[model samples]
Target: MAERLLIGALKSGKNTKIVTLNGKKMTKMPSTLGKLPRLKTLDLQNNLIPKVCPEISALTQLTVLNLGNNLLEEVPEEMKYLTSLKTLHLFGNRICRIAPGACDGLQNLILLNLNNNQLTELPQEVNRLKSLTCLNINYNQLTSIPRELCFLEDLSELHLNYNQLICIPEEIKFLKKLQKLFLVRNNIEVLPEGICDLKKLRILDIAGNIIQIFPPRFQDLKLREFYCEENPLILMQPFAAKHQENIWSLKEITSRFVLNQLAEENPFLMNAIEHYPEVRSIISGGKNCAICGKFFLTVWLECVQFVPPSKNWKISKNLQLVPLRILLCSYKCFNQRDPNLFGISQE
Candidate 1:
């Protein structure tokens, strides 16, 4: 197709400001695209383009660049000229070497997608993308990440799944804004200290790795999802989590919700309760039963890894709530109640 016609199609009108020509697989971008001076977004994905067309640099107003699923071998040095480009998607490409000073001109880049490439190492120039917030580099040939990457201060989500990573950098703990971390299917060994100090981390997915000792310190975390499956992690340190009555995985989940009615009144020992709806009709936090010596229904709470716009989370219901350990005393047995001895209240 003629380049002028394509640029004419990628125009703005009224309140709209986007144009798409995705999956075109054009070996060459139209030479007439520079005519669309008002263009703000460009999507040219799933193409067979062997190289990043330098003509793209003329579109200085571009904010989005989608050249994914193409046969691209290297991003053109001219790409640095698109300083206004913020989101660049180049996943599933034949890229082997990122041009040096690649991130130098991208002063406002917020999102970068370079997954599924043949990259053996990342360019140190990546640290220059100061405004970058999210990055996706899954299924690559990376051996180790640069330690200077700690400079991505505003980065929130980092996806590095299916890489050849053997160890996590200690400076990674410095990414205070990191919310989600996906470390699945790697060759990592030990986890570093203060790994749990990422107070804002919400989703931590390290499944299918060689993890040994999981940190025994997660009490201060406001976690909502925690997945360490397929690792050699042993028992969770119950005491380290400050569980008052029952064994809790972490702290935040303590008596947050209480179910007060019991169906069987005296639930069978070996038969575990299945789902919540089974006890839904019961009144919550109302009365104690004579047989169970506590509230009729059970109460439970769970945790979630509290990471950021990160792409690391287990697709599981990873909630760990410990039930209150109540004394099973008969009313007649309670007549002989020793409040001080059992720490019971008989007011």
Candidate 2:
């Protein structure tokens, strides 16, 4: 009956203003919207549409069109007929190209979404959307961004993460109005020198890369949040010279340690002690005998074993022990010791 009523509403020249079908399996909008000549907003979200039907371009009064979360492979060329549109959403589709004239003459377009697609490059025609402010082309197979995007002088927030970008394009430096930039998890080894030019940049994320150093004057910008984690930065001695506000990590690879030629000499010790990067302290200077408090040359880790037990005191503390120590004494000391006490003959 609702379909019949909608048919009567169209047949009687009763113009409709808005059409919303939330959570419905609308594969395509009925051709009635074009005949109304007054329909403005058409929302077709959360549907099982396999592709966008081209007949939607007849809605000349459409100001906002949402087609998110659908199986659309490409933005149809006929969509440019919606000359009065201001906001458009074609996200979560399988689109592979941002065609040259597919979105032409949309002079008032403000917000555009082409995220989560198979797009590898942005066409030069993207620069025609001069009125665009918020643009999201993230989560695609993009290796580099087309320089034409810098034309969106009004764009503020740009999301381009989860792509295979190796470095920030120099054209990106021209976005004077850009506030937030997300370029994490890329193969970048160094940041662009023109980054400080973005005076309005608040959040700059370049984590999970191999960048080991940053500009000395970067703190002059006074950014609110900076993410530079998981880089190959060593001891942050360079950052320690400033006002001490930059957050850094001291975790570096072993190769960062310097090879020092300096040494220290002592008469009591045998060799020249070399300086290591990590050695902090030493407990005892001179060694002492284990049997008595007498001074000795050295103290070593010896593997001693207990002999037979005592007669009355089965486990007396004074039980005999074999001195199976490592290299400390010469052959003369072993040859001169009494065989009865040490249990060792001349051989």
lDDT of 2 at 50: 61
In order of appearance, the predictions have TM-scores of: 0.64, 0.61
Tens-place lDDT digits, model 1, residues 1-347: 53643744655432234667676547876655665655678787877778766566777778888888889887668778788989999999988888976677899999999999988888888888889889888998888888767679898888888898898777887888888888888888866544666877887787888865443244445555666667654322322232244433322122222322233343541133345543333433333433334442233321111222223433344423211222332344333443321222222
- The C-alpha lDDT values of all candidates are 0.64, 0.59
Per-structure clash totals for the candidates: 19, 0
Per-residue error at 158 for model 1, in Å? 0.9
Off by over 4 Å in 1: 2-7, 10-17, 216-219, 234-347
For model 1 the TM-score comes to: 0.64
